[model samples]
Target: SFVASGTFSRVFLVHPETAKTRRWKEKSHDAQRYAAKVMRENDSYIQYTSDARKEGDILKRLEASQIAQGKEVLTMRCFDSFAVVDEVGEPYWCLVLEWLG
Candidate 1:
């Protein structure tokens, strides 16, 4: 539900939550958004174990270090994730990422 299928990893647009009048006055806020990369299991390259592992390592590195900067004032953050299950109950890994707008 987070992303729509696309040629590359699916891109998602996120909105900032609005705060109550009192809370909004207490802190300064900026707009934030992220894109979740869900590797499509149907893709032929997904069948390669090495490809998955490599991609996972790359993502892990990004998560470990807040080292990647995106456009404008955006930054990439590795958030929570879940496995996509098929009818047969096979689980496919999916990454929940913060997309820099």
Candidate 2:
């Protein structure tokens, strides 16, 4: 179900137990929950999609930096990302992130 929305994306809750596919559970391993940030699919959302993709990139860099420094995670981490065609045939960008809550 939809959980939240930001300027560039909408967030959806991903419960491992209820997920239709086992891919998420298998890929995330011990992770039990996730928040997926899906980019808006409208025609004028090009800028929004770019910004959302940048956010995902920055999150990945942050996680890498923390890992390199041997510091405990103090922030949400992204687990996966991909583009999927929506019901309307629009390709929407998606970033799967840790559900800190």
Candidate 3:
């Protein structure tokens, strides 16, 4: 379900929302896309518990700060939910984000 190697631990290609997820915009589903950045602790020698939660907190803070400062540098939006990918070796923790392109 996830494609990763070397620098990337996990990467997911997401299409625009269907009936499963609510549509954020009025654009055609096929014309829009999204991305999921899966962060894993297995790559490092020191693994930390609640890896997903920590990362989510950091991202949320970043979004909040950017909004507060009125900065437009960050284009993509980070969602709150973490998508759990049932892979072979370990479960991949992912943050579903708006595709940056």
Which candidate tops lDDT? 2
Q: Least lDDT summed over 10 consecutive residues: which range in candidate 3?
A: 41-50
Any idea what lDDT model 3 has?
A: 0.62
lDDT of 2 by residue, 18-57 (tens): 4466665555555588898898433245453355566678
CA lDDT, candidate 3, residue 87: 50
Model 1 regions more than 4 Å off: 1-5, 14-32, 45-54, 62-75, 86-92
Q: Which stretches of candidate 2 lie over 4 Å from their true place?
A: 17-31, 41-50
What TM-scores do the predictions have?
0.42, 0.70, 0.58
Which candidate would rank higher by TM-score, 2 or 3? 2
TM-score of 1: 0.42
Candidate 3 regions with alpha-carbon error over 4 angstroms: 1-8, 20-30, 41-43, 46-50, 73-76, 83-89
Clashing pairs in 1: 34-99, 35-99
Full ranking by lDDT: 2, 3, 1
Put down candidate 1 lDDT per residue, 5-93, tens digits, no spaces. Answer: 65545655555566656844664456565565666544554543323334655666765555444424233455655667658976565
Candidate 3, position 5, lDDT? 43
Candidate with maximal TM-score: 2
